[model samples]
Target: MKNLPQKVRSKKLSSRVDLTAMVSVSFLLIIFFMVAAELRKPKVMDLSLPYYDPKWDNIITCSIGVDNRIITVLLDDNNRIVTYSGLLFYPIESPKILSYGKNGIRKELEKRRKNILEYSASMGKPKNGPIIIIKPSKKSNFKNLVDILDEMAITKIDTYAIVNDFTPEEEKLLASK
Candidate 1:
């Protein structure tokens, strides 16, 4: 009786695992990394060069050198600033020696621009305005060039040139400064 008559029983258990939460967490981590790994944008300055035109004969050249000096000249037999219409050169005003800033070079530029506008209006000619040529000397640093460019923007100058070559007069002026 002890050996033959016992009934056998077995217990059942589930072997499955819930992977939804794990998969969701993995996707969230992936998305977080993707969102956080974006690259930064670089800063830059925009500059435009003036197009050549026979009608645009009037040119204003500003030479920037070291020692915080700028020599502004208009294209003529004598390098001088133009005072009014008919290409009148202001012999009294030799390329004004100016420093950098709102009070210094910026003020001078605004005044010059104002003069050009007045001259064009009086002459009954469409205001092409004076074409500014920026010439930076070897002694001039990058900061000086950038400051001048900022001045150009602040002054609302639409036509300008960044000339690499300097005239003999400009060289002398730069040397003197």
Candidate 2:
């Protein structure tokens, strides 16, 4: 018999892949996205709503006399704002429709603040500035309320209240418009 070479056999290698690096990379990506989402969170504005007392049967009441220190801002539909200093019936300044921005409500607020400060000084009263009351009618939208609140902040008003209860007179006035 002629000499024959034996058949050479090739070694079989395992086909399993190493997934350690891939899993680690996926975890890192997940963490990065979570951190990014947290960093991109929206800003929030702090608002203080009026506190109610159960003891008081009538929460909304008219001032006994006209208070020059108080300013009432009524938010109506169609982006209309009615502002008056003191009582609506006996306002120091008559109610007028005002729009938003520097030329509109902002100007009026600044002017009123100046006038109120001057009046307080003249009367030998404390310079506590004017108290603003914001009333949003049912017809009004949330954006108007937010705009008004932003105005309050821009004007550096420290004292303000959001009163949803509209006076009958205010309702009538809004209805007239």
Question: Highest TM-score among the candidates is held by which one?
Answer: 2
lDDT of 1 by residue, 13-118 (tens): 7888999999999999998888677533455663333344454376542221110122243222222221121211322245556667787767877876787667
Best by lDDT: 2
Off by over 4 Å in 1: 1-92
What is the lDDT, from 0 to 100, of the residue 69 in candidate 1? 20
C-alpha TM-scores of all predictions: 0.49, 0.62
- By summed lDDT, the worst window of 10 consecutive residues in model 1 runs over 61-70
Count clashing residue pairs in model 2: 0
Task: Encode model 2's per-residue lDDT on 91-154: one tens digit a residue.
Answer: 7888899999999999999998888788867766555578899999899999999999999999
